[model samples]
Structures are given as C-alpha cells and as structure tokens.
Target: MTEPASARRITGAGIVLVFVYGVMALAATGRSFVQIVREFDDAPLAYGLSAAAAVVYILATLALMFSRSRAWYRIAWIAVIFELVGVLVVGTLSIVLPELFQHPTVWSLYGSGYVWIPLVLPFCGIWWLRTHRPAAVPELAAAAR
Candidate 1:
C-alpha cells in the first residue's frame, strides 16, 4: 500500500506556496495584459516578456497545485527553472542594456518592481519540492529500511 500523491500535494506549507503562486500568477497576468493592450507599441519587448512571464507563472502555479504524479513534479521543476532563468537573464539585461527595455517586465532587475519576490520564489519552490516529495510505496519503503 502507499500514501496517495494528492494527499502529499496539500500539506500545510504546500497550501501557503499554492496561495502565493496563485497571487503571482494573477498579478503578473493582469499587469502584463493591461500594459500590452494599452501601450504595446510603447515597450514591445517589455510587455511581451511580461506576458511571457505571466504565462510561465500560471503554469508553475498549476503544476504545484496539482503535483500528484511524477509528471506534474517534473513539470513544476521545468517551469520553475524556466522562471529562474528568465528572471536572471532579464535582470542582467535590464542592467546591462537598459535601452532594450523602455519599461519594466515582471522580471526587470530581478523583480525590483515586485520587491524581488520573483527572484526568490523559484528557489523556495524547488527547495520545498525536494524536501517534501511524496512517500514511496511499501516495497520501496522497506527496501530503504
């Protein structure tokens, strides 16, 4: 017998993570949507990247919320890694090539406009996932013992 995967997905800490990711997804999606629709031509690169970040956030949130299988776990890792890469790349570019971004993306300067949460969240997520992985089945549990 085995503990179900879904049960492990919503531990106390997991709930907090889910809530934060949900907020980030909504905030990024809404901000980028408004900026892109209202003034895309003003900062195409910034708005486009912001929109892309929003999508990534949404996917990451979903993956974490429903991480009931190995596939979902892997997807969550991929999304978070992508997010980390995006923030680092964009943060560096914002500093090195300021002219390329007329305005700020969600990842601008390592999420300076968002108080650097974007930079910190992915690391937290990966840590949580690694520490709180689902338990193995009876056979594997015995094998380890």
Candidate 2:
C-alpha cells in the first residue's frame, strides 16, 4: 500500500529541515575550523564553544536527515532546543560581557553573522515537529485504508 499524504508531508518537511540544517552545519564547521586554525590560543574558550556548536549542528542535521523512528524525532527536538539555548545565552553574554568573547562563535552576537537565522531556526523546527506529530500518521493511513 502507498503511504498517506500526511506521512509524505511530514517527511517532506523533515527533508527540508535536513537541507537547512545541513547548510548551517557546514557554515558552523567551516567558521569554527577557520577560527581555531587562525588563532586558537587567542580565545580558546570562545573557539571551543564554536567547535561544540558545530558538532551539535552536524549531529542534529544527521539525525533529522536519517530519522525513521519517533525517538529520532525526539532527539532532534532536544538538539534543536539546545541549539536555541546556546545561541540565546551566548548572544546575550557576548553583548553583556564583550570582554569574555574576544572571538565569535555561531551563537555570538545573536547569530548576527548568519542574520539571526540560527536564532530562529530552532523555533521553526520545534513548531514543525509539533504540528506534524507522528500520531497523525496512523490516522492518515487508516483513513487511506
């Protein structure tokens, strides 16, 4: 039997998210690597934070891309939440304590380098997941049957 439209829609949204996150992952990784290579000793704390954020973005992208289970969805949600918190905290700190961050991270300056998309993407992701709850899939399939 064919999959229901709702299932397809949800999966499609997930695919779109995968693409977006993939781009973010690349940006974060590249920027972090560049900073670390250029001057790791200058601001080790900020550089390390950037690297950690890159890792999280990469993992979240992969999870969303290959996830077939609800557990994976949950993991993605958690990762996205962490990403949001990291951006907010780091952004605020960068503003409030400019001296602390001699270097920038993906979350630095409220993701200003990325046009604040990083700050907003997680909220979008959470909303998409909530609206596309997997529970709707069984209902859709049953109706189709």
Candidate 3:
C-alpha cells in the first residue's frame, strides 16, 4: 500500500540535468588535474580551489546520478549550496584581487572559461531537484528504519 523505496525515477528534464553535472564534473576534474600537476606552484590557491571544486562536482554528480535515497538527496542540496557559495566567494575575490590569483579556478569569474555554467548550474540543480524529487533506494529505506 506504500510506494516502494526504489520507486524514484529521473525523468524528462532530470536526465538533462544529470548530463550537465557529468560534464561539469569531468571538466573541473580535468582542469584541476592539469593545474595541480603542471602548475601548482604558479597558483596554489587557484589550483587548490579548482581541485576542491572538482571534488564537489564529482560528489554532486554521483549523488544525483547514482543514488535515489533521502540521504543522497540531502547531500545533493548541500553540494549545490556549497558550490553556489564557492563560486560567489571565489568570483568576487578574483575580481576584487586580480593579483591574488596567478591562475583562475573553475569558479573564477563565475566560470568564465565554461560559459558561466558554474554560475548557473547550482540554481538549476536546486530548481530541478525541487521539481523532480527522487524516491529513496531500498538500502537507504532499510537503513533509515
């Protein structure tokens, strides 16, 4: 008489959002890897921030794409919020202190390198999640019990 824990399904717009997240995750990870390996000394803060951004993107992608659980849903929200804050703070700092960053991070100037996707993605994520909520996985339901 109750909806199964695994009843969640990503439909319509949800699939597009997941694809975008996947792209962002790959882009950030690749960018950060290059920066860390090739020019870490040139811009430690930028490189470090890029790496951190990549990790957040990866987590977000995984949380949304793979899991259909209440916990992962919460994680998606947290990741999206953190990403928004990171972009805002880093974007401001990059503009205000141009000299502070020898190199730009993924969030620098609100993702200028990627056509502002970083700036826009979080808002989209929040909206999409709100509109297309997923059901919990069976494992998660059992754990929650």
- Candidate that would win on lDDT: 1
Off by over 4 Å in 2: 1-6, 9-13, 135-145
The clash count for each model shown is: 0, 0, 0
Give the per-residue lDDT digits (tens) of candidate 3, residues 1-145: 8866455467667788888989999999999999999989999999999999999999998888754667788899899999999999999998999897759899999899889999999999899778766655678789999
TM-score of 2: 0.83
Taking the tens digit of each residue's C-alpha lDDT, what string does model 2 give over 1-145?
Answer: 9988765644666777878888999999998899999999999989988898898899888767645567777787888889989999999999999998978888999899899988988887787767765453576679998
lDDT of 3: 0.87
Question: Which has the higher TM-score value, candidate number 1 or candidate number 2?
Answer: 1
Judging by TM-score, tell me the better candidate of 2 and 3: 3
Candidate 3 TM-score to native: 0.85
The local distance difference test score of each candidate is 0.88, 0.83, 0.87
Per-residue lDDT of model 1, residues 1-145, tens digit only: 8978765567888888888888889999999999989999999999999999999899999999877666787888899999999999999999999998769899999999998999999998898889776556678779988
Q: Model 2 lDDT vs. the true structure?
A: 0.83
- Give candidate 1 misplaced runs (Cα > 4 Å): 1-6, 135-145
The alpha-carbon RMSD values of the candidates against the true structure, listed in the order shown, are 3.5, 4.4, 4.2
